[model samples]
Target: MRVVMSVQIKKNASIFEMTREATPKEIDDCKLVYCGHGFFDEADIQNNINKNLMD
Candidate 1:
């Protein structure tokens, strides 16, 4: 089965909110931010790539 996860940041907040998925690999590979800090979402990464390719 495939699972989805999410990471979110709140305005004026230092800590991030993370949601875990059912996949162990996904959880292990998940990082806080794009560069390894702050909050980031996997979906956002894919979206960014798609946007860049379309441009």
Candidate 2:
């Protein structure tokens, strides 16, 4: 599965974002903030969106 990884490129800048493979744990944790294409939503991509949102 895949989902959008909304990460901030800078201060209040969320334009620069990407998609990534959605892990079961991620879904259970409600970490999928946004949704995107699977073409770029590779599992290899590191997802730090949830962490950033907490900050």
Candidate 3:
């Protein structure tokens, strides 16, 4: 999955102004992630998104 977002700086803070899913082509070309010693998958991504949204 990919996300298109607009960030803003206000009072020395960064705020996410907008966010949307990115296209397959965009994800393929621009996706960047460093799993390091951890395992990552679609379920991990979905879980993280859900957790953040709840907070």
Candidate 4:
């Protein structure tokens, strides 16, 4: 089984996100996780666009 997870870091203005395709038990370890590929959607995309347009 595989699961997708997202982590957001407010201070850096960035998000630490990834996906892991592993068994149920493997996910519980908290350390035996694989880094997923590709970039996830930014949470502030719409907000930024709106702000820029308004400015």
- Candidate 1 TM-score to native: 0.26
3 or 4, greater by lDDT: 4
Candidate 2: list runs displaced more than 4 Å. Answer: 1-6, 9-19, 38-55
Local accuracy of candidate 2 as per-residue lDDT tens digits, 21-45: 5567875785444434443256433
Tens-digit lDDT string for candidate 4 (22-42): 566755765433333444444
**C-alpha lDDT (0 to 100) for residue 3 of candidate 1:** 32
Candidate 3 local lDDT, 10-31, one digit each (tens): 4533334224544577547755
Which segments of model 3 are wrong by more than 4 Å?
Answer: 1-41
lDDT for predicted candidate 4 compared with the true structure? 0.47
Of 2 and 3, the candidate ranking higher by lDDT: 2
Q: List the residue pairs that clash in candidate 3.
A: none
lDDT of each: 0.40, 0.47, 0.43, 0.47
Estimate the TM-score for candidate 3.
0.28
For model 3, the local distance difference test gives: 0.43
Summarize candidate 1's per-residue lDDT along 1-55 as a digit string, tens digits: 3233443343432223344323566446653232232344566655654454454
Candidate 3, number of clashes = 0
Q: What TM-score fits each model? A: 0.26, 0.27, 0.28, 0.23
